[model samples]
Target: MAITDKFSSKQIFKFLPIVAIIIAGINAYYTVNEGHVGVIKRFGEAKDQQPPGLHFKIPFIETVEMIEVRTRKNAEKMASSTKEQMPVTIEVSVNWTVEKEAALDLFKRYGGLSQFEQRILDPRFRSATKDTIPQFEAEQLIQDRASAIQGIERRLTEEMAGFPVIVDNIQIENIILPAKYISSIEIKQTEKNLAAAEEHKLERQRFKAMQAVNTADAEAQSILKVAEADAQAILLKGRAEAQAIEAKAKALKNNPLIVKLTEAQAWDGKLPATMLGSGTMPIMDLRNSQEKGN
Candidate 1:
């Protein structure tokens, strides 16, 4: 019996190291997935970092905590007041990630990701939104929505510098204003449209009036031109008639025989009705008159 006991003890001692090694291997190694990093802690203090994939650590004394380095999103809805002192609701989303270099510092300070978001990120986001939204009027906020969103994002990013996380992006998902303001805006728009329509109508009427005036002016100009031509024609005709009459008078003065010729041409074949005296008549030749006298 003693001999059998001695052999069994020797065999157990030989396998003890292998069992211990197996246990240590199981506890010493860990895996980190893509987009994740591990923080190794020694004696409850953050010592170093491990990148993605398999990593090893001391079995009992060291511990590893995985942190997501990939981008993450958080959405928050907040009530705020605009520059007009109007009440509004804003829904915003923030995309962020753990800064890899700051991972150990973050873990040491906040203990975990959830605690960090709740204690630091959330408050800062709320404060930034509240501070920025009041700078703009409600109408401006709605009209310049994209600019407002960018402003908020910039403010939030600036405020987040105190934290260990890097802000990747931010967005304003929605903005809700009071009902009365919307109704007032609609009324103003309708009035503006009506005014514009009235102006257009007035402009069209003015254009038509101008067209009528231009047409009248053109017609008056044409009538004046025609009247001038007619007057010129009448003057020319009168001058021509007067010239012909003057020419005939001058020709008659130049030759007295022309008058006798004209009278002979005008006379018909007729004798005188009476003779006042027996002297030579005006129609007798001078030679006959001289013989009679002798």
Candidate 2:
């Protein structure tokens, strides 16, 4: 009986610590921080979610699973650009969050925030990248990269629909092509530049030709003006000579002294042997002397 009593006391002492530990754990409450949500699980399955606050759950049978409630970013690089299989490196990031309404179900299926990338998110990203990028050409993808990234986002969004993951954005970083194609493009551009230069030279020649034509026309006009002036001067000189002769004829026909002088001006229709205006007094020449001697 003494040994049984000693064993009972020892058992009671062990039982007291167990009871205290149970009470303390059951009454404990924890506060959820920013960008986090608390999921209360019963027997390893999610039963309820607690918002950002200090909350309690049955400690022995219930456990709280902490999950990130904020949006998350994931980056992926695609190996090649779709059409030509040119080597390309794509840096793509997606912004995602767990939907508030589906938090419990999501936690139940996916376990925790740590299981997200492998189980639910990364596969969707890979699938979307493979399917969407293959439909686009390498050059077109490089030029319209934004549209390509947007298409990836849309595809992932569609694929992840009805799930707790909400994809916000996707991006494509860089695409690289071969140097041979770039060199070919440069050569073509240089040829076009040479052709443009030749055209400009021809245009300058045409302008110079037009200028030469104008210069010739101006010179011709100046020569014509000089010829016209010479013609007018010749006409005026002819008129003056003719008018002087006419005035002299009219004076000789009206005046007797002038008629006598004009009649004596002729000597057998030859040049005069005696001077007509050389002497101040009357000096009889051949015709008057001959008439007097007769």
On a 0 to 100 scale, what is the lDDT of residue 228 in model 2?
97
On the 0 to 100 scale, the lDDT of residue 227 in model 1 is: 100
* Model 1 lDDT per residue over 1-294, tens place: 999999999999999999999999899889988898899999889888888988889998898888888898989999999998999999988898998888888998998789889998888888888888999998889888777777877888888877778885778889998899889989999999999999999999999999999999999999999999999999999999999989878989999888999889998976554545666764444565688999
State, as a TM-score between 0 and 1, how close model 1 is to the true structure.
0.64
lDDT, candidate 1, equals 0.88
Per residue, candidate 2 scores C-alpha lDDT tens digits across 85-188 of 65555667788888876777787887776686888889888889877887787667867888788788889989888887788867675555567766776797
Clashes of each: 0, 0
lDDT of each: 0.88, 0.80
- State the displacement of the C-alpha of residue 23, model 1, in Å, after optimal TM-score superposition: 4.7
TM-score of 2: 0.57
Cα-based lDDT at residue 193, candidate 1? 100
How close is every model to the real structure, measured as TM-score? 0.64, 0.57
Ten contiguous residues minimizing lDDT sum, candidate 2: 266-275
